[model samples]
Target: MSIAGVLILPQVIQRGDPGEVVHFFGIPIVLASYTSSVIPMIVVVWVQGHVERWLKRTLAASIENFTTPFLILLILPSATLMTIGPVTMAFSAGISGGVEWIFEASPWVAGAVMGGLWQVFVMFGLHWGLIPIMINDVATLGYSVMKAPVVASVIAQGAAALAVFFRLRRDHKIKQAALPSGIASLLAGITEPAVYGVNLPLKRPFIIACLSGAVGGAVTASGGSAADNLANPSLLSISAYLNHGNFVVFCLGVLISFLLAFFGTLFFGIPRSAREEEQPQELSEDLDSGIPAQPVPADKKVVDADAQVVPAGVVVPVAVDEGNTTDLVAAASGHAVPLSEIEDPVFSSGAMGQGLGIRPATGADGSSDAESPTGAHPGRIVAPISGKLTAAMNSGHAYGVRADTGVEVLVHVGIDTVQLDGREFTPHVTKGDTVTAGQVLVDVDLPTVTEAGYDPTVITIITNSDHFSTIEPRTGIDLAAGDLTVVVER
Candidate 1:
């Protein structure tokens, strides 16, 4: 019975009007298959990363990194297929069974309660639970009371996107994207594209949308209208709802939801302050602290300019050379390789940056001095690829770089490296200094440090490692002063 219910939605939408059609575009192919599921999630993760970068640019601080987006995608799809999908089926069957009992005894009361609770499920991401009953009711019973309220929820969210169209004025780019997505969602059933993309961040509009969705859902429930199939809650599937004479009531519900969310947003909110407005506050604080805001070359933007150190995990090392204007000159000239090819495996999987890793630290021999192993260990850590140096500075404990491709690479040698306390090191560039590929970032006294029993193994990793798709290493024992170590791809 549950399986039958789950299949009900697609059957109705596909069978509804002889003229109804499906279109394949972008990542979400309309074909009914599991294979089609993977790409959309990847696209979602990509957008999430883009949003993270955008936040860094506008706010001058990062809210989160790309890892947050990658994890969200990684978890959502598997759960959707393995857990949420099946659980939804069972949940729908249970609800339908309970509703049937109530309707057999008192139809009107059952209708009222179902209507009220429908939107509640959506707020919790549990509406999938109702899909099966809605579909089965349509196919087996030739109609359903389960699907209609859900459609109303879709309308509510779309209306909320429209709210963003008016509410977010400070950032024109977001507004431009939201307007079209908002309208499309109203006419189609997909809300996540807009929810995660635009509405959620625009703030108050999402809240207004949820409230309106609840109202619209209640209206659909009261009418006892049923959707014929799931069809991903899109407008193209609206033919199923057309079967009922209460189409006018459904339209009315949609209208009310839209108006309520839209007007509520306009009357109650104000535009966010301009970016310029916040800078002086930051600068003022910096001045009061006796530290001034230094101007970095416009090319190298910091990824986590203000992020606290992430709790310790595997601390990877990334080396940075200063730009040519300073000390970082290219060992050799070459066109830019795609960023993904040069990134490490752990970083590539996370879409970070391009760079190379050396398995054996230079001084494996026991005879080497405790601090300085001149053979290749400290100096052995060279630039992964050639590019205009983005940054070169000692962050009190470690040396870091911002590459021309806008990647931030940090190189920390040895464990508890920060404990080196800015001793036994030569810092080549000051803050805001430019460097080139393979330029010496720091001159480490390896033998002296090793004599003190510190492992001079250097860690090189892309700080913004999540921006890449893949990074491959070059096949050679020794890389030229400016030879490529990592190859990157978008």
Candidate 2:
């Protein structure tokens, strides 16, 4: 026999970070380079999960909140001759080159402007615009003098976050998470947690942070020292400052920035907890008109026994009682819960029906039957839509339904709206009562709501609107009753 030929495999070796080495299949590998892109999203994910409730409300508000600013941003040119890449390169070279020139001519002014203006950019969430320049400086020039300002700026941001820790009288959990994140950013440059969680919550703290960042950046600029590499702004990388032979200057600059932000936040004032706290208020005149809001179970039955039935094509004209025919009376009048409180993305989007979203009768995670009970058990439960009671849930335990075509929909307002025991509501119809569109279902006291920190995001889900081929929502942008959602063939 020729005998089987035996071969030994060659080990392929790779490089890694500081003295850390590993053997993969007998191949020694070293990890040297780490990219920020490789940065784990865990921190962001953790922050969001912990503050899911606040974030959900913020997201809802953000959707319509940025309308004006978003519109303006849209009007700007989409294309620019000077691409961000080129602009960044030029800007970096200019800032660095210019600073060098300034240092030679008059370092004081240069420091002040750099320190102050850098903070201004950060306040608008525009700091990401400079990342390319920092990366390029390290790649092409072996160092990045442009990063000094940001290191200082982070210190300022941290200070602002700290202010919230002391000033907040409520929501201790939010403050606890924010304070550490802020301190972490000051020491390590991870500002997202601070920005999103704390400083931004208090308007004045945000402003104070910017001012402090600027002051700190100015000090760094005056030191005539610079960073040796473009690296993530974290305490782990402070050694980069040592390359400039002025580690002391860098430390001082960071310290000054923090003090300025902290003291400035204290002096300028962090908004009182009351300012950020949610309060319920009465609905304004804006809440009136268009969608005639009627309480459910209005007397005899939701459908009028003798009411005129129009043909498919004929318009079902709704008679208006200007006195009580306010379309879309505030849905969650005095007990609106944040849309995010539901946790179901589908429910939060309100895509299910007008504003009605189906969620856990209990809180997210199904904590307990007690803490999260909707009073109605799981599966196809009907709830009170507004404050007004039609017939006291005539079945003794449950109320009647709002059915159109072959479908039925359950209506409920607020989280524990029924708990109000119909305090702020007026019942228009009673059990087994017939009701026409535009009928006054209930009267809501909106003012009493905002003062209580309720969002009043009314929900009108089609609990059983599906039995019909399709229930088309009525025209007009306002999402209220009487807008005419047609039930037709799919």
Q: Rate the local accuracy (lDDT) of all candidates.
A: 0.52, 0.50
TM-score per candidate: 0.40, 0.40
Per-residue lDDT over 324-430 for candidate 2, one digit per residue giving the tens place of the 0 to 100 score = 22222222212233334454565566555433322222232223222212222222222322223334342222233443323334345434455555554455456
Q: Give candidate 2 regions above 4 Å deviation.
A: 1-110, 117-129, 171-173, 272-490
Number of the top lDDT candidate: 1
**Clash count, one per candidate:** 68, 54
TM-score of candidate 2 versus the correct structure, residues matched by position: 0.40
Candidate 1, residues 237-305, lDDT tens digits: the string is 767777764787876765666677677766653355522123433345456478766788888876664
RMSD of 2: 23.2
